[model samples]
Target chain A: MTELATTLEALAVHKQFCEDVLNMPGGEKIKICQQCGTCTGSCPTSYLMDWGPREIIAAFRAGMIDRVVKSNTIWLCTSCYSCTVRCPAGIKITDLMYELKRLAIKYDLAPKDGKAPAMTKYFIDSVHKHGRNHEVELMAKFMLTKDWGLPFKFAGTGLKLFTAGRLPLFAKNIRGRDELDKISAYLEAQEAKAQ
Target chain B: MRYLYYPGCSAEATGKAYDISTRALMGKLGVELVELDDWNCCGATSYFSVRELDSFAIAARNLAIAEKQGDEDLCVICNACYTTLAKTNRYMAESAEVREAVSGALGAVDRTYSGNKPVRHIMDVLVNDIGLEALGEKVTRRLTGLKVACYYGCQYSRPMGDFDDPEFPVTMDKFFQALGAEVITDFAGKAKCCGGMMMLTKEEGALRMCHELLKGAHDAGADVIVCACPLCEMNVEGYQPRVNKTFGTNFDMPVMYFTQLAGLAFGADPKQLAIDKQIVSCDRVVAAIPA
Candidate 1:
């Protein structure tokens, strides 16, 4: 590949990042981040993140879309909204994290080590099938496919909850479960038209 | 007063006690709750992480039903559902693109949402609409000596602090006080995150967060911790042993849904309130409440 073509391709990713963030609700506020660390400070799990909220903003400004998408920071977010409420710039940091997560999944850039994406996929699948999330089914699928040791670790609590009748064995399918599929189909067509 | 209730998916399973107690408590308060017919999942945080438009559409489906089914405001028990549905409303009102996409999706499903329905938290309805004075009068057995750490968790008032302070909510505290329970107003972890779904995806981070919340309630000398969200209740109560195992600390705390405790105060039977469903026995806290 020629150097100029490679440069333009890199620039396209940066441009796409900006456009994606700008399209989100309250996404424009990302440009006003003061390089302040309040978001990271307020983040309960920032210590475990590969890139804290503050650093993510800085990276966004630096046009390092590749780096941001490849990091574990977005997946680690618990959607607590602490950073969004605490940011002095009025930036919706949590929303920004969600956008990044979507981008990572779209480009197939999500780290293999991140279990959040898998959990999210299984969760959505459950919703698609039953119109509501079946807790026992979702947990069982995730534990079996993702973490084999979870059943053993959760056995005591699981048995107790089961005895209490809190853990039901069957999922209740809503009457209008097909309505969800229709909604998805419509949205997919809209996206295709946009593209 | 009547309202449409959206019991998020958890209420059917892990949070059934919350559903039972809420119904009993509201019934005693003379507030009629009509469950929203054919409600689906709000997609929670999981949906938005992958597809934003789909999340808004699914969440708005319930709102659309609420608009079609009744004139009453929608009352939501789960914080995540409240936030997701409220968020769809906010985004629809703010962004023309979101409005267009969501309306198109809803139209395909033969439903429509005008974005005018109010999505409310139960605590908000109890404290604001029902009035604390009225709630106080309904209490037959006052929780005179109970020390309650009201854990708001995240999403209770965040990103849209319409009803309470996003950072430090006092609605639960004030609600408990009205029932004559001793409210721990200074609990540091009252509005902190309890790991939510991360408890399954990332155990270490979630366990650490739960540890802090449990420790805060313990330090406040709380006899019981009352939660506003099911995920918070599960993480703090269901995983207390896991938290202790990870943190190497001995902590035994009874975490109940705020409605469960409120039901007891409203003179509802313990069985009716589903108090037996709690993992950590609330028998101590129950005995402490004056008969």
Candidate 2:
């Protein structure tokens, strides 16, 4: 129990995580959570894990940042934002999950649910190269880490799309690659701080 | 006033509704959508979930292009593209090492990324900039009896803030409200993932997640679900039949864009919303709208 309580201080969790995060731009109104379990109850991945929204909030309240951050339960969020609407309290657990995702990637604590953010670099590279999101390249790169047919079916769609002029073979490259670098640096600094 | 408009792949493809309506609405609001000349996909969902750096590069390519165009504010229409581009930008802004690596990767190219723009979701435009006043004027036909369920997909409002209130975002509802529709606020999923890319990969789980959300909306008596993200609209629409098949439930609530709904209420042809393309028909739903 002593170690279970180490991640965060019970009192500071809401203030730091809930309040502070909710104050951010895309955030706000997360504190409106009426403690309704609708978020946990409706979470698609809830059945797949041991932690629920209330429990996670309880954990957060208990200063279990380490536990919360380290727990695979955080990875369960598909970022659907169901709870954000259902919650009478209006806590943006999804946004919290996003924060946790960035942190997990930084701390190497993310799960292998095939959605690990570790693949972010490759995905980002593909976008930078093409100025758009290409599922084909993304599929091949992701499948490289897993099985073969992981991207087979999508190939048909990709072909159909390309032929229909829905997708261009080559990316229309953007010009300010340098500013993107600076922006990346600024954000990386914040991520480091979160870790 | 001049923002770099990155119309992600879907907006150019499956999200024609979004593309057309967004352009139309934004034009009415005095916003211009300048498609990045040589733009590509933002390496949305599948890209990063697959490989990290590659996705970053893909996202960066657009950033570089936007920078060259000298457009600082990048507004994207599709949720996936918006999320991908913004996420990559956020990541790039967050990681010095990644920044260096990505910069080094594109060192050979003349185009560079400044990453200075606040990548915006179009909702930010309607809710924030246009703010009811501009939209209200365009509502030639107010949908007095229309019941709408607002769906703000995950990336649209998550990651600790960017634009809307993630917990209880009302841009969709507001869009409907502006058109005189009744907003249905129920216990259905609002900010949850629609499993956009997950649809083709993991149908069952994805459909289930989407099912629950759509079901909740239907259960709440929503005539239609209003969404900002094109992927959400697509996923909800495409897999809707599968959901009805899986659950044996016959609810047929239409999934539509906030702008599409606005366009309809404004007396645009119901065809404008592309109800025919949708597996879940909006006929009864739109028919229910007060004349």
Candidate 3:
């Protein structure tokens, strides 16, 4: 009886993995994925992903969380909703990908030199500091911290937009930032509990 | 109809033309767009990827302010803002735990979100509130010779699926026809993804995807491709030159926002519309339009 119980406990990997993803807001739909390759077929950027939409779900179902988190699939998702719209099982595949992205960043599993994670960090940092996104500041910081050489690569287009007065130099903050801070803090506490 | 307009951060920068033309067209159509004061960022695609509940909280703060303003409808121009704000609003209303947590957050700022008001995109209000026939009557200049390819860019009708067919949307095509342009109904790039946020990370993939879109529009013989999303505009237009160089294809497709074309049809000054600010020159579109 003790040997049987231990064997049954060892078989709970799939259930354990499923629960991890389902804990996200829109991630419950992954349970209904059906192993269909429709999502992979429908994805525009699937050709570029290490694991397409279908494989991401498959890997997650098989308790390969580490592999899925470290893969480029989650970061490459354009959030176009094509797979979500096309899924016959009504699975919100794109939203589930977003959940994986959040997990990857939280766990520091994201690639060190990955531009996607770098851009995401810079973007969120921009919003966290200023009430609004200061495009100039975000780009400046991203290039400075992430890849100092990226500035020269984008100089031509940057100069054109600057000359056109489309890229504003000054940062604009919303009026009620104190309220935003309160809300951010409240939600952060809730996120800590979930983690 | 009075709406609490949220132009978002991009509307003032990369989408400056969209902002100008949207305001002009709204004013001309007699639609009242009251700016939502002290409104913050919707956090775009980045914030949520970092923290889930915190992303909701930040966006909810904006919705909370809109809710406080007498329950008027919240109108957004940029697709990212529309999707994020509406998603946050719907999520808060649907999930009990989400509502409680967001409510707790708002309470700190002395606010509440009952989810009474509807969050709408510019296209929704343009087609639904101000009907197509009414909009057709206000067109002072007909874009008869212009061949337009309407590009919805994946976010407008998908996921939410509120307004039109997600697979093949014709709302924008219909609107362009109502404005007297020859709308290309068969363009394959209409509902295709522009690989928006991926542009910064996966440049090669994004460029390849954008090149496909440009080729489709070019092959469809479109004079211009109009999009509703700012990121779509940034991707298709900003990356056109690189795509051309990479593919050895000189596809100089002028990607314009639907609002800019609507502004043209409404006979507003092209300068007022900031038509020239577009990365891809709209000179061909301007030449085709009857002055």
Candidate 4:
């Protein structure tokens, strides 16, 4: 094992990660979670999750960021906001999930061959290239880079959609490319400063 | 009613039917929707998960354009766009740090966001600006027997609950009723999630959620599922085959945008509404609706 993994396994929890989570937008509210499991109960995909919503919050409070981050729970969050609305303590569980996803990307913790992270990266890449998201290009890149089997898997649906004229041949580009470029650079600089 | 239309990326391609129906409905309702000039993506869920500021900035660019255009009210058709635009607008107006940083970013592009502009979804405009009574007056074909499960899905209600009950919203149900359709009240999955972005990344899990939604509507005896969001429609309608394959249950529930249903009720041409473009055939819905 690497030195970082050895240290992570030795510690009860990572204090710095706990503090980081606490610092996020909906992070502070997580302290108020009572482990009622309302969020998990309301979640539709929690069954497939490695760590349930309630358990993730408990892990966050316990300072076990490694357990929460290394798991596939963050990637599986659909951002439904059902957990947020149903929380008696008013914990923004969904927002915290988004924050966890952001942190997951920062640490490069997503599993190898994980399509979720790759899909997200491809989506951002599309926006960076074109001012708007191009679904065809995004799908093509995702299939090419992450999952080569996807194109074959979706062939039936693709043919049906293409025949129906639902799939466009090219993505529509927005005007004022320079403005988006400037805005992206400014935000990148700001984020670097925050880090 | 005049508004700036921000048709997100989905409306142009995958959700083109939604675009057609929205335009048809807006035209029939006598509402003017001037397409927002040079509007870009809202960064969807992906951008925000990668970098928060960039996603906010991208959405803010669209808001800044509307702000410059005399700050006309922005109407978004996609639920993701509505949520992202509204969330960014609120953050820009409420947070000094965000406002200053975003303003500095916009200044780099020679644009500004004073946070005076308003962003709303089509449902809000339909329910508030154009009352249901006025809509009822224009209905030429009342869908008296059609049973529709008004599915709001996610984002439309939650993380922001100004327009309707986030949990058990009746705005769509009531609107469908105004169009003379029997709205299904016992739909268990009315406010459930359709696994939005996961439809691409996690197909099996997304299919699981879609199956439940379809089964709920089917169990409730709904002839069709009516929704306002493009992602919800695509996930529920486009993936019905996979959902059935995953669950081993046969479900042929047709999903249509609420605007399409409204367009049909207002006696708009079916072709103009793009009713035939649906992945899951709306033939059942057509067969049921009187000519």
Candidate 5:
């Protein structure tokens, strides 16, 4: 809407994000958001959240990282990155969203809805346990994590695929878990120091 | 150009089509794919979600394997694997802080990733390096009149610039156009999540994503949806029925790896394209392409 500081915060896509993350090849380009409202207009879930891409960029420029983190907007981002390509300014809204998510977790702002980030956690844990994802185990563990009754919800879907030979129920779990753990431990240790 | 092609976990599993078609096409395009001697998973959606460092290290190890294999340049066929590996590779190569930490953690395993490798999604390789003009000449079968939409799933494109113009990416379109197919220009559910890795934890979201992509393609009058990643293929193909039932949207759309379609253009048989493997029958697209 109105100019917050007359600067193209919405236009400044790359600068709106963390400097470290924005420095990557496609990273720096998000800084040119001219805020034409094209992205918000095209976003299917824009109305579902309090703010759209324009506001998200502005908030970041206004030094509103925490506000952006604590809001449901970050979680709601289907991560379409529609704004990135759609923006005449060529902003990388999706990259900004990822950097925000990392920052949220780093600051312990991860939603405690007791589980939302569980998907993220399950994935990382799977990798740490094995160098590769054990699709079957990851699926089982994920359902268990959602709620004990959650598995029942997917039973019908699972059964349909079972008959088709698609859901083999026994996805081959990749081996070499010890090495995965070692690597995981190393990255975890580094992350801890960054905090 | 030489690259250590890492198909990630899905390349060997459900999305094997991506692996097979890519290897075949690479040879046609004059590139060599050296399978990592003992590469592992790159720890996609779930790994990065759980613990940052561990996921990075897990991803880092894969990068190390590729580097040791001696190709500073790499190509990832799966969208999710491409993103996760690129993230780790860049971190290992650029951040001494991350590299040393990952090295220390991986010390017990006797592995370390130098991260000098540049990971290019297969789409970049074909459209950028190989060039559409080259492919246009190589096309033995022009997919005339067959309408298609390029479904650049979240992993294959985003945080990595999401390829093309993130919003209006032209990667898939250019590739299809190279094959002489009608590339539909409609705003679709793609450029969004495929509800990958969420197949378990948050299926509602995943299903929503699936319905959107499939229905979007169908509604846009597309005959097929082309994809670049294994997880996207599995989710799009494997979850189509669930999405239909959950949303009551009736439409059969076959998702294909870009190479699969390219293989068809290059005169590979339907079997070579892995058409029958999809949840939806590929007879529709197969009937359109020549024998």
Candidate 6:
């Protein structure tokens, strides 16, 4: 009887996972995925991903959300929308990838080896700080914290861009930068109230 | 015609040439571009990966400002910005929950968005609004024999095929053809992803993608590859050495923003187009165009 109760509880968690995905904007179309390999076929980075978009959808349907989130699949997505455009079932696969990325970040399920999450964090942090993303600052911060060898790899192109005046050292802040904070605070309050 | 321009974050940095040339080209075409006042970042794809509602809210802020400040459509040059802003407008119109959340966020900032502002790509405005026939007539220097590859890149017409075919966009090609450049219609990597910001995160995947794109242009014997997106321009042009190093292939293809090439075809001096800023010098192609 106890084993039955635990099994039901686990099933409920899996059911909630599907519900969460379905609740995302345009996420309801996951039900009609058709198991076609078009998305995986269309993906440019799927070769590098552990599981392609088709397999991710299949795994999610099978209640392997834990594995799906932990895998490098979602992080590998470039958000190019190639899969979304080609999906015969009309699934927004790229947006679904973004949602999965949010889920991974929210639950601390992203893989440790993945740099995309950290890169995204730094990008958003740059926007929050300067009201714009400073490419040089973003790259410097990303390299110092995430990939130390990046500076060496980027040295050549960096020199060329710098000489051409494309790599600006300073980011120009927008006048109404404080509005971002107010917007975020209001949304946070609304989310807190909803919870 | 007049439009409110959103030069995106890249316009101030890596894509400065695109912005400079776009303005020069538009001025030559007799179009007016009013820069959006105090516009913040669009939150981009990175923000979308972190917080969905926050991403929509921040992107909507730009639209709200555009609505409050202007009656003309918001003209975006970067494909990522174009898609992000347009996508926010789309989700707001389609989902009431999204509409409510975005509106509430805007309300907090003492602004409002009616979700009716049209977000247009520069290519769409160039091709559809200003017909190719008119554009052809304005070309003071026709690129008669210049072989060009019009690299549309991802997000130019994807996830929202409002302007052109998502998988196979031809607006850039058509635009180039109108300028008398021989467009490479069969370029395989025209709409492929350039790995975008992945160049910073996962260099290998991005390098491989750039290799394929460069190889396609090289194989087509393209004198120059024109880009519509800032990231795509940076990747295919700036990362050629990286791509060549990884793939063990020699690729020196000159990648220019479509506006730069258009500016060139319009008799604007090479300096006006910031042609010298290109990593791979376009001197050869510039010489090829029949002046």
Instruction: Specify the highest-lDDT model's number.
Output: 1
Pairwise DockQ winner, candidates 4 and 6 = 6
Candidate numbers, best lDDT first, in rank order:
1, 6, 4, 3, 5, 2
Write the residue-wise lDDT of candidate 5 on A46-124 in tens digits. 6656787678777766666556666666665555455655667666565566666665665466776534476666655
lDDT of each: 0.91, 0.64, 0.82, 0.83, 0.68, 0.90
Greater TM-score among 2 and 4 belongs to 4
Q: Over the stretch A111-131, how does candidate 3's per-residue lDDT look in tens digits? A: 888888899888877776788
Q: Write the per-residue lDDT of candidate 2 for residues A1-195, one digit (tens) a residue.
A: 123233565434434544544443345454445566787887777776568876777676655566676665665556565666566665656656655655455434455544445345555666555544454565567777644564463454345345534444444444544444444454445545765
The TM-score measured for candidate 5 stands at 0.76
State in Å the error of residue A124, model 2.
Answer: 9.6
The better-scoring model by DockQ among 1 and 4 is: 1
Worst 10 residues of 1 chain B by lDDT: B130-139
- Per residue, candidate 1 scores C-alpha lDDT tens digits across B1-291 of 999999999999999999999999999889999999999999999999888999999999999999999999999999999999999999999889899999999999889999999999999999999899988887899999899999999999997899999998899999999999999999999999999998998899999999999998998899999998999999999999999999999988999999999999998988999999999999999999999
lDDT tens digits by residue: candidate 4, B98-127: 788788898898888877678889999998
Q: Which model, 3 or 5, shows the larger TM-score?
A: 3
Please provide, for model 4 over A1-195, each residue's C-alpha lDDT reduced to its tens digit, 9 standing for 90 to 100.
Answer: 112335654342345456667875556787777888999998888999888999998887776667888778888988888888889998878778877888777666666678888888888777767778888888888878877787776777787777767788787777776677788788778868976
State residue B242's C-alpha deviation in candidate 5, in Å: 3.8
Task: Identify the superior model by TM-score, candidate 1 or candidate 5.
Answer: 1
The total number of steric clashes, by the backbone 3 Å criterion, in model 5 comes to 22
After superposing candidate 3 on the true structure, give the runs of residues whose Cα lies further than 4 Å from its correct spot. Answer: A1-18, A191-195
Q: DockQ winner between 2 and 4, please give it.
A: 4
Interface RMSDs of all predictions? Answer: 0.7, 6.7, 1.4, 1.3, 3.8, 0.8
Per-residue error (Å), model 5, residue A63: 11
The predicted structure with the larger lDDT, 2 or 5, is 5
Candidate with maximal DockQ? 1
Model with the higher TM-score, candidate 5 or 6: 6
Q: Which candidate leads in TM-score? A: 1
Those runs of model 4 whose alpha carbons end farther than 4 Å from true positions after fitting are A1-16
lDDT by residue for model 3 (B1-291), tens: 789999988887887888888898888788888888788899887887877677787888788778777567898988888888888877887788778887888887888777656889899899888989999999999999799999898878877877888899888988989999999899998989888877767778988889989999999899999989888998898878778878999987888999988988887877888888887789889878987
